[model samples]
Target: MKTLVMFGSKSDANIYEPLKSRLLNEGHEVDFRMISVHRSPELLERELAKVDAQVVIAGAGLAAHLPGVIAAKLLIPVIGIPCAAAVGGLDAYFAISQMPFGIPVLATAPDAYGSAVDLLSRWGRLDLQYTFDSFNIVMERHKRGLPHFQMLLTRAQAIVDRTKIEMKISDRPVENALNICLVDINEQDPEAPMPYGPAARGSDEIRIFVPALSEQAYREAYAGVAVIRRVATVPGGIWTGINNVGNAMLAALQLANAQGAHAAFLTNAKKGYIHA
Candidate 1:
């Protein structure tokens, strides 16, 4: 598989270098470039217009719009890495993860080689089985704290009940199971050994983080789950407020099923709720 790796600034080399090297070592072609969306919008547009690659990986910090801009122009999947340049990288994380509807970018942690490789594996470029094998052992030893947010729990449960998908709320992940894990960032302790225990267990599981008001909590959780199978955020970001647990659950369900179902689900969900 051929990949085009782009970053906004040369300072982001530490984040994207390992990723590029790993891709090359795995016998995949990589085209690396430094193109800032804000500074060189015209050049970025021109380059993306004729770029020949199956996937595009773009990294940037502080208002990280490189990946979104690439995604807006390309038909291929764009994986975004939010470097920790400002505000513990939460600003870049939100900017990349919370992209508007229709332009989808797979936002990931600063060290996101595993997610990128996993995505390529899913696309038939590599035969790697799983990336979080070590995480499983750690997750098995530690116990997850009981959920603290009752209101969010009730909302998530209602979403699962309505969808008729079997919901299991546990600290550890089930091996080889096709499940969507709903994690409430607001209920986690920053000092906990493994705050993202459930999400670390397997590559088949999808994790949806419920919105939280604390910037510290968000930063810690995003760093904790460095290489989960997939990560998703609430639809409207902060505008959805802290009570968008239901939206997170819906996102989980949407990811759990076929991609074709997303449009229909969004249409229905937007009728009364989810302005985004």
Candidate 2:
């Protein structure tokens, strides 16, 4: 898996490099860059398109807005790591938390702790399910679910009609992920960035991070593993995902940003206080 690590200029390399090294050991290719959201807004904006990262962990100290603008692009997930040197991590937290709705980013503590591996592991699960779903459906019709399809599908159809929104149709991602016994079914996205709305069965992993969601809303959407599926685009949209478990943690950070959590809280670092 590939991850892009973006850090603020003011942040100490002592803290930043260690985090990058951790990801490297975990068998991931990380793009470590020292461009701050506040210092180099122009260059910062450009990298969003350039870096095709599965996950982005953006770190900063003091009043850092690096993760905010990056998440605003509404592309991949942006994780903010608040440095301890900045107001005990408060400055980083507030800056990230104040993001307008619909923008999602993730965060981690300055020391980052054991989160690097924890985050990427989730992405790996998504990739696993994606692979299985594709094979079960396309290769063998009966391989995905309980024996004999016609009767099972009919019953599933009835369930959808009774509750509204497709439930467990054979073609539905929900069924593929569920019947296939996927662990993190919700992590998958309904529609991948592709030519169509959803992809072929099990084309890619979908990681969803939804906050303040109703039971009904969550159930109907994310019913499949297709790379392209239209499941009602909510304001927060789906939190971007990676192909494995570790990156999922990265997605979690960005999703927290969407829910208005501060980036500082993500880290155990400190920030400076305002002066007269």
Which whole-number lDDT from 0 to 100 does residue 212 have in model 2? 18
lDDT of 1 at 189: 43
Root-mean-square deviation of each candidate, in angstroms? Answer: 8.4, 16.4
Task: Write one digit per residue (lDDT tens) for candidate 1, span 1-276.
Answer: 788989999888788888888788877799998998999999998898889786787889998989878866754557777788976676777677665544556666544555665545443421212222111111122223334345445555555554554555555555543222334442334333434432332254434343333334444545434312123332211111233455444433333333343445544553434432
lDDT of 1 at 81: 79
Query: TM-score for every candidate vs. truth?
Result: 0.56, 0.48
Give the whole-model CA lDDT for all candidates, comma-separated: 0.54, 0.44
Q: Give lDDT: candidate 1, residue 9.
A: 96
Least accurate stretch of 10 residues (summed lDDT) in model 2? Answer: 267-276
> What tens digits encode model 2's per-residue C-alpha lDDT throughout 17-38?
8777778887888888888666
Worst ten in a row by lDDT for model 1:
132-141
Off by over 4 Å in 2: 128-276
